[model samples]
Target: MSMQLNRQLPMPADLKAQHPLSPAVLERKAQRDREIREVFEGKSDKFIVIIGPCSADNQEALLEYVHRLAEINEAVKDRLLLIPRVYTNKPRTTGQGYKGMLHQPSPDKAPDLLEGIIAIRRMHIRVIEGTGLTAADEMLYPENRSYLDDVLSYEAVGARSVENQQHRLTASGMDIPVGMKNPTSGDLSVMLNSIQAAQSSHNFLYRGWDATTGGNPLAHAILRGGVDKYGTCVPNYHYEDLMRLLELYGERDLLNPAVIVDVNHSNSDKKYKEQIRITSEVLHSRSHSRELHKLVKGVMIESYLEEGCQPIEGERTYGKSITDPCLGWADTRSLIFSIAERA
Candidate 1:
């Protein structure tokens, strides 16, 4: 054999029992879930903001960010629904570098999967208990999602993983709203196909058991733009792009026809500062087309306590990002209110 097995880890159920959530926390999470669902279901017109750091590398800093989100959620409750991102796993284009907190719970230390699992769970529980915010996470690994299912209110299949079969099938099995981004190639058709798969029940092998999903009707689209053959970033958050999405949704029998503009990534070309301008343009686009306004449910923004990204080595800035650069707390706060004003 080419590989040796490590110690078997505890099941997600057992781990939950070990660090169980309080009734109050569970209830709070349920409420957040429902509010987010209403946006995708068309029962509510309030805009949704799935905003946070690109990778949650530390518990204290992540909690600090979530608590701030809670305060803002209170102010914009009438016009916007806020869901903070506590993503623990990050996708690397070439299969190298820091995987995430799930791989290295302590960034300065070496990777330890066992401790990493417990650390991530505790961090998520802490976020819910302290801030009353059930954050969103990227489903980078389908098998690992069980560890977070109870605490996460939302999930997004990243642009790189949108076409994977396991990702689509697992998303179908999930009950919470899952946003599937258009592939890096900019193929909207592939994205639509993935969504169709996620919204349709399928019998498949999962976690050593035969499982069938009831179809996640809330699975929708996240247009994060894409890269062309020449390796140029092609943005799709414009008025024309949104109208095209509206037309695309019309051709499908998909439920709750909706889309979320990911203001970072290719959409902003990873220029964190562009998030503000992109968001303004998207809100302006909504102002012009009623169809565009109705179809776009929210925006996904990458922001942290400090603005921009930094290297892992050397003296770390207290709240700067270790992964992708993010809008600082000041800019993030201002952007939320601006979105509320326009919404």
Candidate 2:
């Protein structure tokens, strides 16, 4: 075999037993799960902001950041439903550096899957127990979803994974909202198809067993923009883009049709600061056309306590991002208010 034999880690049940969630955390999670579902199901008018660091590199900073979010949620409670991104597993385009807190809880340390699993589970538990918020995470490893499944309010099938059969099948069974993003090559059909697959029943192998999933009605699209053949970034968050997506959605037989415009990624071209501008434009688009206003459910923003990013080695500015660049705390708060006003 090409791979070395790694030791088997403890299952999620045993791990959760060791670090149990308090009744308070469980109550909070149920509340958050319902509210978020209502938005995707078109039952709630509140806008959602799935905002946070691109990668949760440090726990203290992340905890502090969520605490600040709790404060912001107070003022924008009427207009916003916040789902902080505690994205622990980051999908690397080339299988390279800083996979996430799930692979290396400490950036400087080597990969230890067992410790990483415990660390990630603990972090999610803390976020919910400490802040009364059910966080969001990427379904990078389908089998690994078991660890955080109980705590996550939302899960994203990233641009790269949206087309994979396993991701589509797993999403089919999830009760929570799952956002599937357009691929890097700028293919909307692939994303749409993934959503379709997720919204229908499936029989597939999962974690060494035959599993059946009843379609997830909340499965939907997330436009993060895309990269062209020439390697130039192309944004798909304009008024025209929303209209186009709506038309395409109309042509399909889907349920709970909705979209979430990602302010960062290819839309902002990783400029980091452009998140604010892109957000303003998307909200404006949502406002002008009632059709768009109903179809556009929310927006995703990459943000943290500190602005921008730094090298993973020796660079430890508290809340700054170690993966993709993020909008700093000051700008993040202002942008959230602006989005809420328009939402």
TM-score of each: 0.98, 0.99
- The total of clashing pairs for model 1 equals 0
What is candidate 1's CA lDDT for residue 29?
Answer: 86
Residue-by-residue lDDT tens digits, candidate 1, 107-183: 99998888988999999999988888888999999999999999999999999999999999999999899999999
- Candidate 2 residue-wise lDDT, 262-327, digit = tens: 989999999999999889999899899998888999999999999999988875778889899999
Q: How many collisions per candidate?
A: 0, 0
lDDT of each: 0.93, 0.92
Candidate 2 stretches with Cα past 4 Å from truth are none
lDDT of 2: 0.92
Tell me which residue pairs clash in candidate 1: none
Candidate 1 stretches greater than 4 Å from native = none
